[model samples]
Target: MSWLALWLLGAGLCDLAHSVRPARHLPSAVGAAGTLLFGLLAGLSSGADLAALPLLAGAVAGWGYLVTFGFGRGRAPMALAGYAVVTGLLLLIAQQAGAVGGAFGRWVESTPLPVLAERDPEQVLLLLAVLVAQMSTGNVIVRLVLAATGTVNPGKGPDATSTLKGGRLLGPMERVFIVGLGVAGHATAASIVVAAKGLLRWPELQARRDAATGPSIDDVTEYFLVGSFVSWLWALGGLVLLA
Candidate 1:
């Protein structure tokens, strides 16, 4: 569980660093290296068998590579598929090692926070991973989906800066809201959030329809619909993991 926390924290920091234009590959590289080192240290501290260390290190390294470089360079579908595979493998390893229970579970149970008190460490780690994904990773997924579906063309008309102002901030906020509501057992409220987002964006979308220049209404609408649905799906998927 400590190793899981370290990996997630590293991944989240890497994603946050990559969000800044000036701090590109170096931050991610350092994060990958750090995750490997810290994960090993965590395993050692937690008294995990030495035999499992290599596999744990390898999994952390692989996850770092996927999030930082593989996803950055590879096709969207392939990268996303690889992410799912690696995540599943890591969870399996954790489960087998008994790292998903025991001390970590006790710690979580002792914590006073209502949101976390009932959660096992594995679920908490998974929630943290999901939150991190909702940040820059979510943006990557949305853009990749749009690109794959031909709803958006790279290096063409109104770049992200000119067109989708504030989307980066908005995407994470909405995902967090949805995930929080769902975790609190407010599924209907989460649905309302989904509808409200569409309503809020409707005016802008309609304005685009009236404009002569910029991306066509159809293109913008497709981008919004595809991106929003994929983003919501990621949050919902996280909720499923918590369950």
Candidate 2:
């Protein structure tokens, strides 16, 4: 029943809500609840029975519980890995969802929401979910990776990755651009975007080498590289789903 799309929609909404409040350690119960509500609406609107409710609610709850209990602990890497594995599993199964499928997709097509009604609703919903997830959830996921794998510091924090600025904003913009390009059949052009980021940040990295505080030059570089790669992968993964 469009489990993949439904889960992505739920996870995206959860991250979005958390991002708005700007709290990393906070739980995403609201988003979880939102998922259930969307499921219920989609089911009812599409004239489907409520039999899928138990599974739907359980899945959303489990995801929410994982994310809610995972962060801010010493197990960031483990938690991140778990999340990735689940996402991959979902993506694998998403293909099994037949066309015109997912009560959500049908319900979306039934709406008077202009533009949205005319296209493949499942694709649109999935695309929208990816875009929304990239906006906030992408940043959070990168942060999780950085927190665990950031460069080593003897007397300082593991990462102290706040040396470079504007990444939170820049990462999302670049990801959206890449996803859009991929979806538009210009995937090869994404290399330009990748190159552009390195060129643009070269000066900042150089300047950080002489900075009086924060992570060392190498640490900052590692932070940038790791975060950037993760962000790119997240975006590319979404593009793959679209493909």
Candidate 3:
């Protein structure tokens, strides 16, 4: 396994652990720390295996931006969409930049030490698909499950998603279920990407005004649905170019 992948996997685990405990700020703090640690580790691990580093860095940057700027007060569907897009863009930009050296500066220099270079085109494409799904679903599940379980309580007043601000939505068993669901969702998306382009297309486009005609079920359905679709699209693009 790539060192950057290991570090990121570890950090993601830490974030999950922190979400388990709501009484203490330690969980959130640990999560933030884990994000930063993953970024640094990615930079250090890049070497010649640049792709791994970008995936890790993108995840870290996405989480970092969400934690830093904070989401809007209203659960307005548009606001939520904006938030998700911004987070996704931050991650994508960071991953692309750091992986192949865009604007973050060349943090990793080539060296002569033997490294486990994964050159299989098919494997590389699969890895990219899995990595994107992992980060996106991991994040969404954390929030939804945490809120559902009462591990984190939605704050008083009108916010989107749930009724609690901070708490795990489900218990240990349910949390496991969430993780499983995330993995399954990733696989499902990948299969769709590999199968048909039409399978990934979303709901029909709506006029800006007609968008509000419904009960706004779009809040929950849109992000995950569109997100999963887009991630696979990204993976497909990578696969066509690389694989």
Using TM-score as the measure, the top candidate is: 2
Q: Number of backbone collisions per candidate, in order?
A: 0, 0, 19
- For residue 201, give model 3's deviation from the true position in Å: 27
Residue 134's lDDT in candidate 1: 73
A best-first ranking of the candidates according to their TM-score comes to 2, 1, 3
Give the higher-TM-score candidate: 1 or 3: 1
The predicted structure with the larger lDDT, 2 or 3, is 2
Model 3 TM-score on a 0 to 1 scale? 0.33
Over 159-191, each residue of candidate 3 has an lDDT whose tens digit, in order, gives: 433321122222222223333333344434444
Full-model lDDT for every candidate: 0.65, 0.70, 0.37
lDDT of 2 by residue, 1-243 (tens): 255666677777777776677454333566667666765545433333244444545565565555555566566677677667767776676555444445666667678865467557666767777787788778878877776775443234654544567888999999999998987779999999999999988997897778777667786678778889999999999898787
- The regions of model 1 sitting more than 4 angstroms off are 1-10, 21-25, 33-74, 91-94, 100-109, 153-161
- Order by lDDT, highest first: 2, 1, 3
Residues 1-243, model 1: lDDT tens digits: 444455554655565666765254555565566555544433343445344545544554454455445434345566567656756665666544434445545666678998887776666766776677677767766776675566764225564325556777898899989888888889679988889988988887787777777677777787778888999997887677667
- Model 1, position 57, has a per-residue lDDT of 46
* Ten contiguous residues minimizing lDDT sum, candidate 2: 44-53
Task: Tell me how far the alpha carbon of residue 71 in candidate 2 is from the true structure, in angstroms, after superposition.
Answer: 3.1
